[model samples]
Target: MPHFAATLRTGLCATVLATALLGLAGCVVISPFGGHDDQLRETTVQGDGDSKILWLPISGFISDAPSRQAFGLVQQQSTLATVTRALDKAEKDDDIGAVVLRINSPGGTVSAADEIHARIQRYHETTGVPVIASFGGVAASGGYYVAMAADTVIAQPTSITGSIGVIIPSVNAKGLLDKLGVEDASYVSAEHKDIMSPLREASPQERRIVQDVIDSLFARFVSVVKAGRPNLDSNHLAEITDGRIFAADDAKRLGLIDRIGHIDDVLALARDKAGVDEARVIRYYRGRSAPRSILAEAATGSGMNFSAAGVPIDLSVDSNAGASQPLYLWQPPGAP
Candidate 1:
């Protein structure tokens, strides 16, 4: 009788647990779509009627990827598509009078940065909206490259703002392979075909060829800087473009940035440029068709599980596998 009672109890507990899970699942599924009309009605314009400054954030490493959705959760990597969409939305919004690009990046690919810069320029020209760049913790190389499209660039007093140069980093595993008694037997068409092969050392001639490419890209970078900051002294051009970083104050003195101020100051500058007495500040967020559920989070292992203090740990590793390419990026001290 005791064993039968125990079996009955186990069955009851399982039934209850299943019921509870079903209830939670129902809540998660229904919450996102419930009261759609009410949600639409609640969507009201922020601050005063129309005349607003759009706050567009450009954070993380810039790339031309479609989206940064990882594990079915949004990762805060700034991609070309996201930035372009934000600019398009701002351009169409009649309420938006100006744009403030809030940048906090150590730079990224040359092509991606150039594309974003071109898009911003087009948006400004098409809509006649005054765009201002507000620098955060670190804005260097391609980060600064994109900011050149803005009418004015502002940086915080302590912001690390410059590392204007190109770099093409490569790793040679020949020594490691030699130690491990592993040899590369792969065949190639020509001697210089495997230009930056990790299995072998680059020949002097190959090194010269790579240097020529770098020099050409460097000259292009110089031309862009010269055109962007026309007031920059010709004498100091070589000195500043030598792959060295600078603080915000030095950046200003060197004509890299316009002012040393915070986001509020940037907003005020945007307001003045747009000639608006009082304007609302609106931030554009990516719209979602459906809200993520706890079940989805559990299945994909999304949301924060482990953190240091209050910051979630970043487990993503950057494996720059495949061919090496030139990058207009700033590598911080001790970065691999």
Candidate 2:
């Protein structure tokens, strides 16, 4: 059955590839790294007569996940490593006059968001280039946190733009385990070592300790927001930072965003701030080299395409499995 399933998958991939080639003639199948070079060259041509406005996208979940190419698949959107490299390149490019951070995210882990925020701040400090954050459909929690580093933030009128707080989720399956007649024999050096273990209920002391950590992190989040938005009224600070999501209009009213505008508006703002009448706009793409094992896998003619648009089959082990970590993330009610 396993062999049959593998054969079926191979046949399906071959059919899909044939269909794509027939339907999309003249399409170039560039390697992931080659695509980045192609895009860079195209943008260089576009900027021949003007300064450049680099559009760096911050899409999907913002995490410090290692490069997806290490798993032999092109990552679709921003990861910390790729985003940092893009900013570094932009900072060194003399033709790049400004940066427009196109943010479309519901946020991710706390440390990852903080790292990206600091990188953006450093880019601005070193280059003196204007940074405009253009919020997309949703930019909540850590998404909004990173945007705070931008000199100006613009959100669409319908954009969901706030959810300022921290959350550390841990599942407790003690009841389920008991129902299944399963007993966990996990051992640790300290009582709090396995405090987040799903097989057992957290003790009151453990709960208190975790709550204290959350409180401290929440206070730090508030301080960062305050520093970024000094003009925000103190009266509305508590309400705005209470982990409630806000629409763009309410966000602007509460001083969470600078304006209600779209990507085009952000482009104009970037141009004006950079003192350039005309500027070429470009976005960065990941330039990851595929491993020899991946190349060998492709050589098998297994009818698989390890491209960005292709579904990834992660063969690498996840380091964060079963771990409880703090997040600056926002999930709408009913979200899984």
Candidate 3:
């Protein structure tokens, strides 16, 4: 314990010294060490430009925190409020031509995703700017909901996209608790006081109640998908949205995505979609602790394509940085 405390103290002293040295040099910058948030990038580009292209990368499950450690990182890039502010700014800026959302994520919470979709739609309606959805490695479930707002969609040939479904996995350790000679004790003013606790398996009635909540949310997901992608065959809505992932080629066949391409391809597609022969392109990132040029995301885990607007990026382990944990709940965390 003493040794551990000494190590923490040493690390703290090193950070302080680093800061002091940088302050003295007037040019040096202290690097973020082994902290949870150090793995993500949050630099958002938000200025008036002649460019018609706007790239927004989804690097983590979006959630509802704006802390530097939460949303402001090198890996867990982008957030709900940041995107909202950027889109709002773009709408007011006549110099900005169009928007392209470069998505690479696994889906998250229904509410956050819907909020972003609504904001994108509002920006489009207000600015008369065409929004293009470009799937990076993947864009699944809630991520695709935001994409549905796009005037057109693009994806990589191998990009994993789609998974139009809702899920809220609950865990119960009551059996384990019993084995350990323990049980949870609680007092409740309402029947749902323990709704979020996993110490005990939910009763059948409780399970039904939770299912109803998820179902209502799922219906909204269906509605958004139906409303956003009109060209998609309406009959296949329920069939495709069974929380299944699709390859770009198959997705295109299903009308889930319009075409197959990468970032540069997305820019070109945006140009054609916006009818701008020479469109200036810009990207919107929240902010960056370290510049992204030196950073590259780790590889995909599952060989099968997984889709979401964003998934976690891990920076501590990768040669550069790994997938990150996002602040917004629009996407889930690395599965426990």
| Pick by TM-score: 2 or 3, better one | 2
The residue-by-residue lDDT of candidate 2 on 1-336, one tens digit each, is: 999999988987786555446434534333322233212221331333468887777876778874232232232333577678788778778888888888888988889899999999999999999899899899999999999899999999999988999988788898999999999999899888887788999889988999999999899889989988887778998899999999998898889888998766887898899888888776554223211320111111112244466676543323333348998889776665
Q: Who wins the lDDT comparison? A: 2
How far residue 304's Cα lies from its native spot in candidate 1, in Å, is: 7.9
Report the C-alpha displacement of residue 22, candidate 3, in angstroms: 22
Question: In model 2, what is the error at residue 190, expressed in angstroms?
Answer: 1.2
Could you give candidate 1's per-residue lDDT for residues 167-274 as a string of tens digits?
887889999999999998878898888898899888999999999998988787777788778887677888799989999988999999989997668877888887
The alpha-carbon deviation from the true structure for residue 60 of candidate 3, after best TM-score superposition, in angstroms, is: 1.5
Off by over 4 Å in 1: 1-49, 66-78, 287-311, 317-323
Tens-place lDDT digits, model 3, residues 1-336: 999999999997786566545544555343454323222222333333355566555555644343222122222224577677667667665755668877766765566677888888888888888888878776887677778888888888988877777776556778999999998898788988677477877778887877787778877877877777677776776678777788998888878878887766776777776677766555443223323321243221111112356774322212112222211122335644
Q: Positional deviation of 259 in candidate 2, in angstroms? A: 0.5
For residue 45, model 1's alpha carbon misses the true position, in angstroms, by 11
TM-score of 1: 0.77
